[model samples]
Target chain A: MQRYKIKISYDGTDYSGWQVQPDRVTIQQVIENAIKKITGQVVKIHGSGRTDNGVHAVAQIAHFDIETQMLPKALLRAVNCIINPDIRIISISKVSQAFHARKSAKSKEYRYFIWNGDQVTPFLYRYRTLIRQPLDVAAMKKAARQLIGRHDFSAFTANPNREVESTVRSLGMLKVTRRGQEITISASSNGFLYKMVRSLAGFLIRVGEGAVKPETATEVLNSQIRTARVPTAPAKGLFLWHVKY
Target chain B: MQRYKIKISYDGTDYSGWQVQPDRVTIQQVIENAIKKITGQVVKIHGSGRTDNGVHAVAQIAHFDIETQMLPKALLRAVNCIINPDIRIISISKVSQAFHARKSAKSKEYRYFIWNGDQVTPFLYRYRTLIRQPLDVAAMKKAARQLIGRHDFSAFTANPNREVESTVRSLGMLKVTRRGQEITISASSNGFLYKMVRSLAGFLIRVGEGAVKPETATEVLNSQIRTARVPTAPAKGLFLWHVKY
Candidate 1:
């Protein structure tokens, strides 16, 4: 069997997320089903990581095994022709059999966009959140800087039943920028716990509104309790941007 | 009564067009109904030009007389609150009573976007056309230069019943750029006849594909026959970018 690495782009509006569930429509299920129809084999495509429902991905990496040794270009075209129009196969290339999408990744990046204008733009409503009140960028930046190191992010994760004994993870970068009425928040980390990015964004928004202080992240880090963190923001405004090996 | 000029933006996928029509929803009808609900008076907004169905606008200029005196900022907020979510009022300001949206415009700018990649993106599918082909940009640019300057553009209009006395129109510029899998065409003119910009784009695409000669536009213009021109492109990929007074 030969393994293939594929780059994908999708609009997550009508999807249940990247993972395949029994009765739900997902990106993985759609693609895998299309592959089965093309190759007549039930194949499992392993993604770099799972994105929550309603979250978009500009370039999601995945790996799958094929039984036949066909040309990569033909496989790309054949798979795309069978998949629905909402999902797209951007590129495909052969990879080593041992290349695992999740284990080989060194870091991941995510971006959250907000439209901080009085009126919501019709063109941007699907991709951005409309916030009528102007956010304080300086406060958000100050609060975000405190999260740029290895620390226990237990408070920022919503999975109360998390089994991992070590909750420490290294944060590579956190940036906030305001252009006109649009605000963008980009964060990178070695690994993220479930719902961690959404909770961090929610807390940063509260800090930008002056409801919380800049050092609130430190307090949340120090406190191992999940009740100390802010609510999780909606998944529709979040995006899985890139993955680095 | 005070005359107010408003700048508007809309995603026209759900509307019939910029003008009111029977048995269909239109951008004009939706905005007018919202205005009537806000000020308790009927308003007639004169737009710069009529856009075909599924054509979007980034900055459409319009003027209307309001009997109730209100500040520009307040009017902007009030109108936005009542307008449909698909249409947005970007800016509003008081203008001279002599000003007219259609007659007082000195120039107009329009943009057409095409995605030339192998796969189409769902998020951008409604906004742009997916043209999966290798385009010759140099040839398209060479053909576009012949359209500059004052010329009778009867050959570039799709309307057979076009009754304009003089088809002489002055073009400011036309540029074609290829970025990644996208091709963008930006054109500026003092005025455009019925279906002129769409027809020009269609003709340029044919030229880019080597189906027509580079000097085909000049030949069509010299012929002065409506049947000598190419067909108008789909309205979904066209945008009224801006209007200069």
Candidate 2:
């Protein structure tokens, strides 16, 4: 068996997510099926992490093992040819047997887009969330600074699917930037809990709207409890930007 | 009856074109239908020009007359509510009755986008044309400069639907710009003939690929004849950018 690491990019609008479930069309299932057709073997691929439905990915890393003699370039072409155009295999490379897609040490970056305009542009309807009212970006930026560094991010995550030993994470960066009517919130962290990024975005949005004070971010983090105040932003606005291993 | 000038933006991937036709879904038909629903009267709207199928518009100007007392903002909202999200009326304001969408235009700007990359981004597949090979932007720019002046542009047009007394048009601006893997060709002219912008884009692309000399643009224009060398670029990459009155 030979191990291969692959980078993928996907438009997740019509997909269930990165994980497979019965009778649901998912990014993982689509790629796995394409690999099965090309290699004639049932092979399972492990993603760096799962993205929820309607969330896009610019560069998602994954690893798989297969017993095949085909070169990496040929295998990449064959799999891409069989999969839908919305999901693409960006690159594939041979990796050591000890490398794991999920367990590798590094960080991940996610971006949330908001169309802060009277009406979202027609071309961007599927990719961005619309916030008709103007947002206080300065307030959002001030609030973002408080969330950086190591902390227990329990308030930022929803119910966990698996047993988690700790909710603490080292946040490397949290930035808010605006270009014309588009506002982008970028977050980078060692590891994120379920819905953590969306929760952070939602909370900051409230702060920007003047509904919550900028200091509330620290209060929420120290309380170590998820509350209604930190609403989960819509999935369509989020993109899994990069995963560094 | 009151005349109103409106700015529109549409994702033209699904519609046939900007003009109304029998038994075809078009931008004109969609807008007219929405207006009829709001005003309870069949109305006719005139566009500055027609865009082919799969061509987008950032701010296509149009004008219409209706016998109603509804305010412009209310009418704008009503029409948008009835129309699909892919088509939007950016703004509507009362205009002089003498104003005509097509006849009163001073100049129009159109843009063509090319993704010069190994693989087209998944999210941009429907919005841009992909050219996998590297292109010489300098060569394309040199060729574009030759087209920026008043000339008989018969070679740039495919076929005229209506009889034209003269093919002469003032070419105000023709610029080529590249940002990362995307190349944009912006053309501004007093007016364009059928498929004129696309034809120019196609010719420039050939020059960029070193398949044609930079001086060929003048030769083709001076010939005043449409030939196979000036291919029509794909509609998906074309956008009606702006119209100046």
Candidate 3:
């Protein structure tokens, strides 16, 4: 069977997340159904990672096995035609047999957007978190610096059903920038735990609001218990930017 | 009575465009209802222009007169609290009694977006029109230049309910740019006839597809017949970007 790597992008507003459930519609289920319609075979798609409901993705990588003699362009067109309007198959390429979407990735980048202004813009409200208070850029930056490098990030993750061997992860970069009424936080990490990015954003927002000191992250990191030290920001503002290998 | 000019933004996907109709809910009706809830007075909003159904606006201007004494900021918050989440008031300020949202504008800009990519991005599908074919950008630009200048645009407008004094309007600029799979067309003019921008976009798209020649617009303009033009494009892809006074 030949393995194909597909670049995907989706709006998670109507989805119950990326994973398939027995009853609810999901991003994975929709794409998988489209693929089945095209190939006439029940295909299982493996995503790089899962995003929660109301989240969005610009470029998500996934891998699937299909025994086909069709050319790349033909396969791309066929899949896109079947997918129709919702999920986009940006690019499809044959990958090495040993490649795995989740395991082979070296780093992942995520962006969180905030509509920080006196009034919310209706056209962009769904895509951004509206915050009336201005964020302190310097404080957020200082707090973000503490998150870089390898550490046990148990404090930042949310409750997950699955088990993890380790809670330690390396963050390559975390930066925040503001343009007019929009504030964007971009983070690159080896991998993320469940709700890690959202929780981290919530922590930084508290720092920016002067509610917590920049060094307060160390306490949360040391204490792995789930508490009020940090709160998970809304899922609407988070986006899976890209997956790297 | 004091007249206030408010800049509004709305996602017109759920509403029946900007005007009120008996059979459908509109952005105007929603805002007016919210205003009435706050002030207990009937408020009629005058917009820069009426946008077709499913057409979005980034900075659509409107004006309403108020007889009550209330701070602008407090009034804005109160009205926003009453307005549904789908619509929002971005900013409000007192305007001269002589100012009218429609007549005070010197020029207006509209943008039409088309996703000319091989795949449809679910996140952007609602906001952009999807065209699968590879568009000829240079050819489209050459054709768009012929549309700039003052001319009678009778052939490029839809059938109107009322008679207009003149069909002639000045075209300030028309620019088409493509970045990756996204194509953006920005058109500016002193004013527009009903369905004029959509028809112009439809005409340019046909030219880009080699379905019509660049000189076809010249003939259509001189014909003074709406039947000579192509179909008007969909309203979902059009956005009233900004108004310059």
Candidate 4:
């Protein structure tokens, strides 16, 4: 059996996200079914990580094992031909069997888009989160800076009822920028918990709104509390931007 | 009766253009329906121009008369509340009763967006037209420049069946700009014929693709023939940017 790594991009709308579920349409299931039809084998494609419903991905990396003599480029064309236009196979290449999609990732980047304006443009309704209030970008940037380096990111997760093995993670970057009325918050981390990036984005947005101070990031990180962030940003504004292995 | 000038923005997807049809859903029909519901009167809204299906607008100027004591701000909010998220009334203001939306407009601006890349971004699928092949922006820009000044633009018009009063129109600006993978072509003109802007855009794109020469723009214009420009750009990429009255 040969393992192949594939980079993908998807709209994430009209999808149940990256995981498979019974009787529901999902990105993974759609691709798996297509693979099954093409390769005549029941195979699971392991994604770098799962994205919730309405969360888009630009360069999501995944891997799957198949018993086929087809070349990587041919497999890519075959898969892309059957898949819908919303989901596209960006690239495909042969990979070592030891390389797992999820475990082999060194870092992942996420981008959250916020339209801080009186009203969101109708054309941009599906892509950006509208915040009809003024936001302090400098404050948001300051707060985002504190999120860099190693910390227990329990505060920046959506799942409160469940416990994870560990919450400590190293953040490579936490960048906040305002271009016109749009505010973008991007983060790169070694690993993230469920809804971690969204929660972090929500926290920074609150800081920008003057509801919270820049110093609150340190407090939340040190607290190791699930409810510390209070709310997570909407999935529509979040995009899985990159995954570096 | 008081005439109100309204600036509107809309995502033209799922809409059958701005004009009201017998059975098809349209922006004007929806707005008129909402006005009927609010004011209990059937009123006609005169738009600056008609947009084909799937063509968006950022600042589409329109005027409608109604017998109402409600303030302009209140009217704006009320119309926004009833309309779907895809259509938004940006602003409403009192205007002279004689002000006609189409006839009184001094100039109109339209913008066309083209994603000139190997792959189009999924999130921007609905908004931009994707062209995978490389395009020469300089060639396109040079070709676009020929569109400036007064010219008989029968060649750029789509309709061959309809006889217009005059095909001569003054062009204000035809600016072609490329920012990375996205190319934006904005044109300001006294008025445009049926699909005139789109046809002009198509001509420039062909010039950029090396299918035609930059000098062909003058040839098309001077030809005084409709078939001089063959292809018309798609509606999804066109946006009615503004109207100056």
By lDDT, who's the top model here? Answer: 2
Q: Over the stretch B1-245, how does candidate 1's per-residue lDDT look in tens digits?
A: 98989899999988899998898998888878877888888999899998888999999999999898877898788777777667888898899999999899999999998777786776787778777788888898988999888888888887645755778788798888899888888889978888888888888888888888888778877787777448787887899999999
In model 4, the runs with Cα more than 4 Å from the true position are: A35-42, A67-82, A136-152, A207-225, B39-41, B136-149, B212-223
Q: For residue B186, what is the lDDT in candidate 1?
A: 89
Against the true structure, what is model 2's DockQ? 0.58
- Per-residue lDDT of B36 in model 1: 84
Interface RMSD of each: 2.0, 1.5, 2.4, 1.9
User: How well is each residue in A138-216 modelled by candidate 1, as lDDT tens digits?
Assistant: 9999999998898888888887468466677787888989999888889899798888888888888888878888877
By DockQ rank, best first, the candidates go: 3, 2, 1, 4
DockQ of candidate 1 is: 0.57
lDDT of 4 by residue, B202-229 (tens): 9988888899999888988898787745
DockQ of 3: 0.65
Model 1 stretches with alpha carbons more than 4 Å out: A82-85, A162-166, B82-85, B120-123, B164-168, B179-181, B227-229
TM-score of each: 0.91, 0.92, 0.92, 0.88
Candidate 2 lDDT over A1-245, as tens digits, reads 99999999999999998999999999999999999999998999999999999899999999999998779999988887777778888999999999999999499999999999877778888789888789999999999999999998888898643435988889999999999999999999879989999999999989988999998889988998888999999998999999987
The lDDT values for all models are 0.85, 0.91, 0.84, 0.88
Interface RMSD of 2: 1.5
Better of 2 and 3 by TM-score: 3
| CAPRI-style class, candidate 2 | medium
Off by over 4 Å in 3: A160-164, B84-86, B177-182
User: Lowest summed-lDDT stretch of 10 residues in model 4 chain A?
Assistant: A157-166
Q: For each candidate, report its DockQ versus the true two-chain complex.
A: 0.57, 0.58, 0.65, 0.52
Pairs in steric clash, model 2: none
Candidate 3 local lDDT, B1-245, one digit each (tens): 98999988887888889998998999988888888888888999999999989998988999999898778888889988877666778789998799999999999999999889665567566678777788888888887888899998888888643445888889898889999988888999989989888888888888878888877767877787887446788887899999998
